[model samples]
Target: MTLRDFALMVVVCLIWASSNVVSKYVVSHLGVPPLFFAGVRFVLVALATAPWLMPAPKPLWRILAVGVLMGAGNFALLFIGLKTATPSSAAIVSQIGAPLTAVMSFLMLGETMNRRRIFGVSLTALGVILVMWDPRGFHASMGLLFVLAAAFLGSLGAVMMKQMDGVKPLQFQAWVGFSSAVPLLIASALFEPGAIEPAAAAGWRFAAAVGFSAIVVSVAAHTAYYGLIQRYEANLVSPLTLMTPLFTIGMGVLFMHDPFGPRMALGTIVALAGVLIVALRFNQLVSLVLAMRPRAQ
Candidate 1:
């Protein structure tokens, strides 16, 4: 990668990783309902990109649909997961989306899943189960399940996006922001009832989170991510994104001061390893390395 691309990757990582810590802040300090927070974030994002929303979506609506699932549904669920789950745990669960996408492609798109991919996916699921099964607290249940749901929706959206063409990332994000916010607001209203009032009472701290989430996390991070996609193949780019969780785990530990017990540590490793296997089989790794290696004289 060029220096420019490398720096962009770091920026992408920072934006993606910072989201976990910021979401934790919104939930813990502002006491905003997770879905409501997400709604606010997407609404801001939509407004920011409103000028671009015109222009024919046409067949591109299919691609925009994926963005909705990924941007709104995935984020909404992830925030809710964080409400009761640790940032580290939520990071790990979100990684499950990669493996889930692979499984989904095989089922929905009729893609062939080699044995390595299958094994990797299976291990990934097992790791998630172990991490979620925290003999105490809300483990193996709401906290874990919500994050997993986030992963599933995100993965599904990714798969759908892959099949479409011609939609720019910014355009896609704008549509996603609009599509996602409505459902999120409805869900927040029904479930949390007082969601908006508390956020209003809290004021700027909550407002800052919404701003950061929309401008920095969504726009900046995703723009960098899309730039990377322009330079690299999806397979190459996607696997490295797994690193986001690691960064998230670190942020959770250092900034949030969330627990980093042996269980969480072990679970993270196992889950990451599984996701790697599923997403980047040994053969793919070998091919990538060989491609990058200098040719012999």
Candidate 2:
């Protein structure tokens, strides 16, 4: 990749990472209901991208399943978890998705995993466990569990997505938006009484968060990342995106005032290393390094 491409990728990671900080503020400071906030964000995304909703992806049921798992199931858990969870812990724990996917694919699709992969998987789990032992409190542990559940759902959705066809990035977002929005809105209304009014009263914090998550993070940043993935090897793109979590942890400490210490750092390092192993082949790693180097004379 060229310098410009590298910069674009960095920007993408920042946009993605900053979302955690934004969401933490929205749920903790503004006191928005997690599910309701997620519902509203998707409502806007669905409206904005409604054009792609038509000519629905073939095997409509599969698309719907992906939407539910990737959209409603994952975000509902994540945002709820964020209500109590620090952004830093959320960042580290979410990395478990790579190993979770390996497990899911092995069980669901009969894919094979070698010993190295199994060790990486185990390492990922242990790292998450270590993070959960934080001295902060039990609520943080519960929040960690919620985010872990979200990670599981996301991994399962990724496996399902592999089975899908004819779903463009924007089109997939359209499906996720439409499929997730209604049920979430319904659930939020039923369970989170008075959620909407508070969002309206919260003023710019709520609106800014919604716009940033729905449009900038999901629509713009995700699409840009997908474009890079399409142009480059998956391994190359995957490792670079790890910057998102790293930055999220930093932003959590800097902006959200999330507590960070050796425990969090150790857990993050272990979890990310495992994710890196799961995501990249040795050859791809070398290629990625070469791609980053300046051309020789």
Find the candidate with the highest lDDT and give its number: 2
Tens digits of lDDT, candidate 2, 123-185: 888888888785766654899899999999999999999888778889989999999999999
Please, what are the lDDT tens digits per residue for candidate 1 over residues 147-242? 899888998998987787777878877888878888888888898898889899988888887898899988878877997998887777777787
CA shift of 194, model 1, Å: 2.7
Alpha carbon RMSD to native, model 2: 2.5
Worst 10 residues of 2 by lDDT: 131-140
**What is candidate 2's local distance difference test score?**
0.89
Model 2: what TM-score?
0.94
lDDT of all predictions, in order shown?
Answer: 0.82, 0.89
- How far out, in Å, is residue 274 in model 2? 0.5
Backbone clash numbers for all candidates listed: 0, 0
